[model samples]
Target: MPARTSRMTLGRLLGLSRENNRARDWFFEDSGNLLPHHRHHELNPSIPPLEVTKIALRLRHLIEECVPCELEESLITQAHSRVITREVVLAAKEAGGEEYRSCVVFALLVCSRWFKRQAHLELWDATLHNVRSTACEVIAKAIIEGEEDMSYLLHTVLLHRFSILVNGKPTPPANAVEKAVDLHALRVICSSGYQKCLQYLWRGWLVQDEDDPTVFVDYRGRDDQRYIVHLDPDRLRAPVYQNIARLLFSFIYLALYTMSINSVNPNGEFDAAEILLFLFTLGFICDEFTKFWKAGYHILSFWSAFNGVLYAVLTVSFVCRMIGLSYPIGHELRHSYDSLSYNFLAFAAPMFWIRLLLYLDSFRFFGAMLVVLKVMMKESIIFFALLAVMVVGFLQAFIGLDLAEDLKTDEIWFIIQAMANSVMQSPEFDGFEKFAPPFGILLYYVFTFIVMVILLNILIALYGSAYSDIYENADDEYMALFAQKTMEFVRAPDENVYIAPFNLVEIGVIVLFSWWLPKRQYEFVNDVVMAILYSPLLLIAAYFESRKAGEIRRNRSRGEDDDDTVEEWEQIEDQIDFEAEGWTKRCAAVKANVETDPAVIEVRKLMDEVAELKLMIAELKKGMDGANGKKKDDVKKGSEGDGEDS
Candidate 1:
């Protein structure tokens, strides 16, 4: 039989699993401690709260005893050299047993109640805040080293789960699991001087050096540096910059399409703008097709579905426009096709503007609103399902009544339309009364009451509930969106990124000829072509990055910190008592007072004395009772002996 599927694999606990490490040597190793390795059914919410707390405390104590090590020397050397080979990552598993065990304990501690409330801050201070040989350092170093699969590690560890199991399990959590970027992780990284470590990872993704293909280049200032310094944090390759450019392209293309429909004559020959718009439309259709193929069912999200409808309309309009252009200008068919094309294109206007919200979600308000809207839409499904059944039942009743009376006075379509209008608050009661007089009017009134007063209110309540849930966690929801947006660029990476209309050029020209070329030659050709095509963007990026670097250097020379400092004073502007002591000082004072107060000292001493006295009294009482019991037993035995002799 295959090895039994184990819960809480040692590799995962040690933070060296396949998801986080590219090395093949990273495999599942069970700790072999049965109690600590209990399955989901044995522990979790199934157990009593007190028992759970005791177990969690035991795990915390075990974790505290572990001594985690810093990044290995070989890993540091490889990082400095700008390339950490797979051998190094694999080698770690063979010889770094103690280090891996330490990581396991740290992981357990982080995923527990030990990392909550005041303990949360203390844990951070103990492990991540200027503590040497820390688990946090291991993670940070892994990210900075840019080896194996660090993306998963970064994404996984920073994610906060509402319902995490104390012990690992194959089954997912039964309760609703709410995951978001950890605010504590964000705060700690910003405040505890891990800024450069994060920057290294960000820059690794942003900067794509022309010379290096195998490794992410780290651009050091010195000329003697291992990697090239020219493209350190290349703004052109940055997702933020690329996404902005794409948005601008879309805006311009949409504008041109609108102008062509309104201003340009339908029968006129294609102008430069019209031709460019057509090319962009084709590019968009192709991009959509590619996304659908790669993403499969995942592409069926709300935004994607909206784009589907928008693109479908655009496609039909374009096809009609093309067919119309082919026909003679004065022909009847040509005129009809032109009108149809314009009408269809005009119908897509609202979609174009509505699509703007999807892209503008980088803003906090927009991001949070999108989440709320998504929740509302999901909740509306119940309302729609109920409405559908009611509509069917009511429509059948109206249709059957019309047929039964031969009152062919109203058509089936008319009755259907009237019912829809009633739902919209414009009921035609006059027509309903003409059908069965009293019964028809009564039924119509009942339906209206049920729909308007009951169903509609239920829908409103559902919407309110959905909105409240999203609103309560609005900040976390927005952070999750932000993290997702960042990960989008990290995941599903394209070796040669061809954005929109430029993709047409890449597909039509480069891809056609690249089939016969060697892999290396093909990559070289792609790089050269991309460089030539995006030279203007690259030039702009270089200028900005250079300016930013200069600003950093100047700040360093002036002995100013390069990091962003949280202005405590500025944040207190709204406070009424500007002269009042800060919370930090007050907290410190309270703690000091509790520790040093004379009355508190006296109380503690008295309590200790009382506890000792109670223990002594209990021991003395036990001794006296044992002696009395022995004497009673002896006397009873003597009496029994006398009776036996008689």
Candidate 2:
């Protein structure tokens, strides 16, 4: 996880095997009401005085207690209210209806009355500090690897809210519930140990885990929790083929769930396929519970982070299907939760298909293109980020001016329409220019000159330069990508790696015959048989591992020590480069300084020998080429003579 990996400590492995002091797994226990039942409207004003302190304190405690995910589709409270947060708005978009967002909207309405006062601001700041403190408490208690998950708390806060407040001391909006909700979400996530938990799981899953590099595992009790920390580095990694088979089975289940015809079957009827998928999902959920047993330490990567998201989505859907579809739950609850994961899978399913591209990148031609694309994307990120910031600034300025009173006020939709209209020469802009004076015409010109001309050209130039650089060394790019993937496939563990589906033979062997032998021998024999069944993979892994080791040995022999050192190949390239200093005079001055120094005389003698050897190599290559040309000519002449004879 992260680019830097963590290994498991021996103490943690002992804990996993010892099986003592097993802790209770933390889970999502619902808070019944999200918002107040009664409103503080002034006609009767029946509600008590708004006690911000009590509300903040209570909310913090609830967040700390609960998991930061939607176990049930809707909140317990039933109330109608205006939209207050971006999350609810996005959900509405996905659902194609506003009814799905009622709970969150209503909760924000309850906080709306006191959202902008000095007392509330102070309370809000105190709550954030409390959130971080709560997170820090868990972090301090656990052994950490990668960047601390709680470190993201300050970052997400700064990224979303900090910029707006820092720039100009503008009047804070009355409906600042957006920022409030984000903070609340962050608090819940951090306090729930979600981030750390995900990190730990990812470190175990994606990066060969703590015990073995090639195996993916599921545990009955989690080892990342603060109270139950067990960082096992030597947990037996199951075979890669077994994991592949498992993933394929998951796909089969997904296909059955989505594509099976319902008309032929009766409504709410149970089927064998459905039962199997339910069993698998239930097992996945149970496996997730173990991570919570020790759930407050992490080291994560992008893939693992997304895997956590998929886990949440799948659980939401699975629970909803079990309760609403299978049992007697209400229609809305079932439908919403069912849709929750379906909507996410709509986006995520394609991602799996696209990842096959990475495998394709091992091919020479495709690898060059992928490597080039990777280069371009990395270079373009900062440029695009800058453009995004400028767009946000201008768009906010235009909104503050209230230029388009007739059009929609939604910031997201406005940005989309404006980008499209700007590119199309603003077909609807003429009359709107009169809505807000000076700023309106100014917006049109700035859009034309900057967004249309300057930024677009700069982006083009960046792509052109990146393409040239990559294409110039296309072969090297291909080899590097190929080599990187080879290392990933090579350095796998020697034990317990099975060829699944067929490895049923190994499991059957264990069950029928294993009772006679010692437990250790039984395990060893089963593992050996499984490995023998998948001998091809073992041979491949061994071959690459040996090659990689030999390469390292050769590199080390050239004095590329573990300390500050460059590769031998890179050192030779650097010595050959005459234009790194730009002008001929700079190169000359450097050479002269080196030549005159007594300390460099011995090195200069070695340099001369290298040059002489390079020249000799060139002469040999030229002679070989001349001989090859003569052979080609002779072959051509012989073919012509044969034709004449015929």
In terms of lDDT, the best-performing candidate is: 1
lDDT per model vs. reference: 0.54, 0.42
State how far residue 568 of model 1 sits from its true place (Å). Answer: 9.1
Where does model 1 exceed 4 Å of error?
Answer: 1-98, 101-237, 264-269, 407-410, 551-587, 590-646
For candidate 2, what is the lDDT? Answer: 0.42
Per-model root-mean-square deviation over C-alphas? 17.5, 30.3
lDDT of each residue in 364-415, candidate 1, tens digit only: 8999999899889999999889989989998888777877788564668878
TM-score of 1: 0.60
Which candidate has the top score in TM-score? 1
Score residue 349 of candidate 1 by CA lDDT: 84
Question: lDDT per residue, candidate 2, 21-136, as tens digits?
Answer: 33222221112122112211111111112222233333333333331422221221112111112333233223212322112221222222232232355774544333333332
Q: What TM-score, computed on C-alpha atoms, does each candidate reach?
A: 0.60, 0.36
